[model samples]
Target: MKSLLKALKRCAVAGAAALAVVSLQPVSSAQAAPAPVVGGTRAAQGEFPFMVRLSMGCGGALYTQQIVLTAAHCVGRTGANTSITATAGVVDLQSSSRIQVRSTYVYRAPGYNGDGKDWALIKLAQPINLPTLKIATTTQYNTGTFTVAGWGAASEGGSQQRYLLKATVPFVSDATCRSYSGYGGLIANEEICAGYTAGGVDTCQGDSGGPMFRRDSANQWIQVGIVSWGIGCARPNAPGVYTEVSTFASAIASAAAGL
Candidate 1:
């Protein structure tokens, strides 16, 4: 996994411009926008309230009463101070519960290269009263579907969602995703890939660190992945990859315990 991650970092550095060009295609010319999945009904109620929009320029999920989980890259390239805020039970961005961040804890894996172990926890000044989320423990993939919700751009190069948006996507196998040239072998054990390889139903820019959740036997949602990185919004053979929340369950539990 370490070697694979190193290779991925190297690839990201070497092909940064090419990757950016291929992933962030302009969608402004299109006459019609893909209809966003509506809230309520099938959508999980009160779930997005715990979902946080980080002031560090990324999105995240609130797992506990006082803990907000997000991507490590959102902290910025240099090891510098950054401010973050958390909002709870938010349905409409204009009129949602908001809270100021008290502290932040970033857990970079030992000898971490970059983007791996890309997870962080934000401590809120006050505890939220929403339902706590669960992290998956099984290695099951491509067996079930999951949902990804965030306040990200709808198109490749478009404006971020004013309100929260969500879409359901099927999980793709590592071997299948590994067959791609750009991101094939880079998919690590601590990550999972989803979205349509043909380019649709994906998380775009500003979606980083959002929650990717699957339904359990009881029909309750369990967080499986954290929106990490991808080639683009949705492109052929380029599925959105995320940090497996289950892989960092212990780290999250420990961090939350500290708060």
Candidate 2:
């Protein structure tokens, strides 16, 4: 399978395969499980109740009691046949306390042209009382310590993580982020960059559709970005790029408010 992350990489270059999709492969136990969030540590149980694993092989954030916010590319169209299920309320995929919910409603942001703005909402069959991450209307995330969590591979081409992992990444300005070769004119206003220029930490495959967020003054976690795409898993000059959450706050509210 072609690396879904190659979308942003090869697209920015000439004569590339040109697949603008990111697909998650079902993790097999036979393959060694590396870790989640490169250069990060394991998250304590229940640290993030909103974090969930999509049975379709991706991660998501429970935006409300019944609505889950994730990347638009993670699942197919929202309809009766949308058979995706979410396992929530647990840190480990193997946890016995995990709650499963089938997606009864799905909405992919209409503005998702794939250049950026890759976000979606999935409504659960039933609501579950779990901590939720609010979408930020403020872009105070100019530069600060952001946290990204997922069950993705710890490194590029590495195995998927069995347990959840958390990592701290510093925000990189658009000016500095575009300074890298092959990335100029590729960074969109709908996207934000975070990580070290030297490369050490990032969210890899299977981590797509997950949240990249930070704490606010109210001591609450607010999502600022969604793991959308990257050139590779934590490489120099190529940091983790995400769908700027603030840009889509209205879109999110409009889609999820009435439901």
Candidate 3:
């Protein structure tokens, strides 16, 4: 199997303009085990610490009381008996509240490769009491102005954060993101890009599976994407790509039982 970053790089080069239509490989089950949780300060506004921390280790999102959205690459490769857990309402990993997963649903796109259509859903053992994020399907995201929050490393080759870190970034056009040869145009229709031209304010290792949110016309927050991969943390012209939540609106609704 190819490294997530390597697969993304291939997709970028192979189909730079049509990356949104590519299919990627599912994440291996052996690599799906939960990772250590990091702690940090809560975001000031439009921030959800629970959202970032719960799936940082598993690469998932809290979509409903019992639903979590994650990358197929993160869970599909696991065995039927594989167990996944989620931690919520946590600002400090050492002593934060958490929830174990009762079940998980990995939605593998037909003909999955290491570089295309990597997405999945996980069901929690119990419904969480915290606020759920609203899903946005309308094409409200475009160039400029967006935010990505996660528990990945703060810098490329840097150590992971102890707490959730939220970064402000701008969305890049498909044409711009495609220019990178390594991604192999793996960016598909159900994806979007966000980050800086200079290496800063981007998601790095351990940030996968987090939410990339945008404000809709109603001024309400909607989850637009799930963290995917990047060449590096906030590398110039190498914005991080995410599974476009809006594109999978029906799938998410269906998986969550219309949550």
Q: Judging by TM-score against the true structure, name the best candidate.
A: 2
Candidate 2 residue-wise lDDT at 131: 88
- Which 10 residues in a row give candidate 3 its minimum summed lDDT? 14-23
TM-score order of candidates, top first? 2, 1, 3
- Top-down lDDT ranking: 2, 1, 3
Residue 40 error, candidate 1, Å: 14
Q: What are the TM-scores, per candidate, against the unseen true structure?
A: 0.76, 0.84, 0.75
lDDT of 1 by residue, 103-133 (tens): 4444433334455676766666667777767
Indicate the worst ten consecutive residues by lDDT in candidate 2: 14-23
lDDT of 3 by residue, 49-93 (tens): 447343335334677767777666555543232365576665444
Task: Compose the digit string of candidate 2's lDDT tens values, residues 121-155.
Answer: 88889998888888888677545777888877666
- The backbone clash count of each candidate, in order, is 4, 0, 40
Question: Which of candidates 2 and 3 is the stronger one according to TM-score?
Answer: 2
lDDT assessment of candidate 3 = 0.53
